[model samples]
Target: MDTLFDLDEAPATDPFDPSVSRPYDLLRHDDGADYAATVTGGGSAVVCGDAERVLAAMPAGCVRAVVTSPPYWGHRDYADPAQIGHEETVFDYIERLADLFEGVRRVLADDGSLWLNIGDSYTSGGRRTRMADRNNAARTIDFRPDTPEGMKPKDLIGVPWMLAFALRERGWYLRTEVVWNKPNGQPESVRDRPTRSHEYLFLLTKSEKYFYDVDAITGPNGRRNRSIWDINTVPLAESHDAAFPPELVYTCLSHSSERGDLVLDPFLGSGTTAMVAGSMARRFFGIELNPEYVSIITRRLAGRAAA
Candidate 1:
């Protein structure tokens, strides 16, 4: 298995920063030479131009499961000229993401499942406000840290529903919308509505019959008593400007995949998915547009390997 970081030589410019020229040059490297070596060892990865192009490189029907959080439309500036989440229109964003998933479907096994974790977005007072912005605002306002925490920033806006609908239109069967409830969510004081506290984990299947080892990934509690599952929040060593919690990655991976299965993260920002996948003894294939984040994820994965 050839990891994306096993390049022959480092590029001249940083790949992730918006200020840098030829930001995608690193992904264009001919690292396929190391693919077999890496994959055979049970943990391999490749970084490509985009999810669409990356999916092309994968062998059809090779992947058993996909547990990823694609770029939330209009969320962050990935420094790439073609940002996946920062689209000009929501319709364009949905179409773009759906297209990527279509490619994902091609590479997935017949019984594979895609556990997609995504939040929502909203327009506030004629101005578009991201859920992240609202969280930041709550923090800036000095809201009581102990107040009831609501949904992840993405849910505050509504991207999950839009994505679910889009994926459904693309022939995916919506199996379940699992709620990832954060036990230690940030405090918020919203006077207009009830405090939000959970995000959606849409489990989609290619067919009614899919390969899911639910018993292997179930929580210590051992029962799906409710759609909500409690998880802890931990900070990253070096933030990638846009990233979700590793716990989120862990939960999705454990619940949707098994050991030695390949997990694909198209928006591999900061490599949280890769890092967690590596730690859990799973194969990971990631496609990150920004080289800076590629480096960050590589360094973090290397650290985990060392640890």
Candidate 2:
């Protein structure tokens, strides 16, 4: 395997520095032309493009496990019109995600599984503008999606379950829903309801009997893993706003995949999935639309190689 760049030496550049142009140009992997497989310990590739477009070029049934957190509906805009999560209506957002996962199901191995992490959203209450929040400056938005039909203002949209059932309708087996409890979740300004502190992680499979190792993810009490995960949310000091905690990815990887398995993450924000996959000796590749975010992925993976 080719070293990403001599692991023995210090990394030539810092990934967090925006001025650095070439964090490392990660080659796009398609069919048998997978340069990511050449990394010394484990392979990783970052495809910089829209998720649907990039997934089209990959081989069928090639992925052993998928661990991803697609963009949440009506959340912080990634500044791309083509990006998901900002549909005119909530149902439209679900349709778009369901349609994209159809391609994901096609590329998944028959016995493979998908661990999806998604958060819910509230109705816009007819508000068209969103001011920047001091806690999360990226929450600023130029446009706000209208509340869905038959829903009142400030209603909990339940987007996670909506998308989960949508995928189940598309032939995915919805096996489980894991509550990801964020003990250090960002404070919400709403006083009417309890401060939201959790998101949903749904485990879906392509077939009835899939490749999940129950023994691998035994709870601390030496029993089966429970539905609620008490993992803290990790903050990234980078341009990408929503980088899910690596512990979440690590737990998903542990339960669903083995070493050398090909793991896929369609929404590779900040490359957390790829970094954790490589550390565990699993081959990984991901799709991201932002070019700047793609640089973050390569720089991160390169840092892992150097370590």
Candidate 3:
């Protein structure tokens, strides 16, 4: 094993400071290569680029697992036009995300699985508010379609299954829609409808029989775990917005991948996937469009290394 870092030293610089330029560049050397030079532990390359372009650079059939929760349709605009979730309509958002996964399919191993978590969007009344406990703006879906085109206001757009079906049509096998039940979900003010406490995590695979370890995620009854996963929604203590809990990320990676296997998280918000992958001794490659959050990932990883 490579001893690329020791746990006792102060990091080269602070990752949380917005002033850090390409935080990884702190490790850049006189030689042409950069901190991403070696591909393990803190040196893992988390390129800040469009997911499609980034995935193109990876070797074919190399990634063992593709786990990510793309920005929900009508969600926070990472201030980048290239970001996926800010599309005009639900179907358009679905198509755009599915197309990106099409690129991902090329990089995933034949026996690998793709786990996607997406939240539903409701037709808006024009007032934008923070997402349930995630401390990010819940963007209103931009286009107002006629009644024939989409459901009326206050109706939930089925974003998760729509993308899942689209991917299934694109030749990936749709495996499961695991419900992420947030037991401590933030309260909604809508009196007309019941409060939503869950999101969907769809598992897609390149082949019929992939590398899921049923025994790894089994429940106390000694059987395979059910579809519903009761995980609470919590922000990263590092103040990362729109970040899912590390427990959720750990469960997915634990069930689907093995130690030392390569995991890919293209969205890489707050670096939860990479953090979990590192703790479990798996290699991770991540891509993020937002430079600020990339800094968060750098700092989060440094904290782990310094521990």
Candidate 4:
């Protein structure tokens, strides 16, 4: 297999420098050679690049499992045109995500599973701007897509279900929908409706019978795990705004993979997946679009290794 890991120099040994971290400046691969080589030659890696292009270049069946949360549509402007969320229409955004996950499906092992954490959004009601919330500053954006066709203002667009069914149509099995109940959910100022307190985590697989360790996630009660996961949302203090809590990643990985399995995260926001995978002794391959987040992952992984 022509693996895409390309290293130009010896891997950085200092945990602070993080040999596993690879810098992919947007679509450019010039600086990622060393990191790529480390991934191909060693166990784990974090790369900076467009998820679609990076997934396309990787060999088939390369990862044992995938756990990710891509940017939500109409959520935040990631300061990149190539970013997934912010499409002209809701359908456009869903189609783009489906297309990107097609590459993800190809690279995933046949017995592998995908744990996707996606949040829902409401139609902007033709509003062009979103004011920054005192609780979540990242909510501020200059542009929001006009109300999607056939949907009125304030209608909840079923982005998570839409993408889930879309991937099912593309041959992935729709396995389960895990409700990620957030105890510390951000407060919404809406008056009429109840405050939103949960997002959907869809479990998908390439085949009907895939690798899942039910015992790994068995609760203290010694009963079967339920679909509702009560994991709190953990936000990054700097660099990245929204990040997956370590407990969330830990739950998904424990159920889907064994120790030392290669885990893939196409949308490695805040590097939660990689960090948790490392702690569990699982190998991780992460691709992030923003270079700033890549730096954050570098320091985080280095910090973990040093500790």
Estimated TM-score for each candidate: 0.74, 0.86, 0.81, 0.87
TM-score-superior candidate, 1 or 4: 4
**Model 2, C-alpha of 98: deviation from truth (Å):** 0.6
Between prediction 1 and prediction 3, which has the larger lDDT? 3
Best candidate per lDDT, number? 4
Q: Give the lDDT of residue 10 in candidate 1.
A: 21
Candidate 4 worst ten-residue window by lDDT: 1-10
Local distance difference test, each candidate = 0.62, 0.78, 0.71, 0.79
- Residue 232 local lDDT, model 2: 80
List the candidates ranked by TM-score, beginning with the highest. Answer: 4, 2, 3, 1
lDDT of 3 by residue, 1-307 (tens): 2211222232322223233222233322344332232232442457777777666555678788988989877656567778886666677777888888887998899999998988887666444443453332343233433222446656676778788899999999998889888888776666787988888999999999889898886655787778988877765666456786777887888789986677789899888787777766666778888778888888877676776
| lDDT score for residue 156 of model 2 | 93
Regions more than 4 Å wrong, model 1 = 1-42, 128-157, 217-222
Residue 15, candidate 3: Cα error in Å is 22
Candidate 4, 63-119: lDDT as tens digits: 889999999998988898799888999799889999999999988899999999999
Candidate 2 regions off by >4 Å? 1-42
| Candidate 4 global Cα RMSD | 7.6
- Residue 246, candidate 4: Cα error in Å is 0.5
- Report how far residue 207 has shifted in candidate 4, in Å: 0.6
What's the C-alpha lDDT at position 82 in model 3? Answer: 82
1 versus 4: better lDDT goes to? 4
- Please list all clashing residue pairs in model 4, or write none if there are none: 5-36, 6-33, 6-36, 6-37, 7-33, 7-34
- Is 1 or 3 the stronger prediction by TM-score? 3
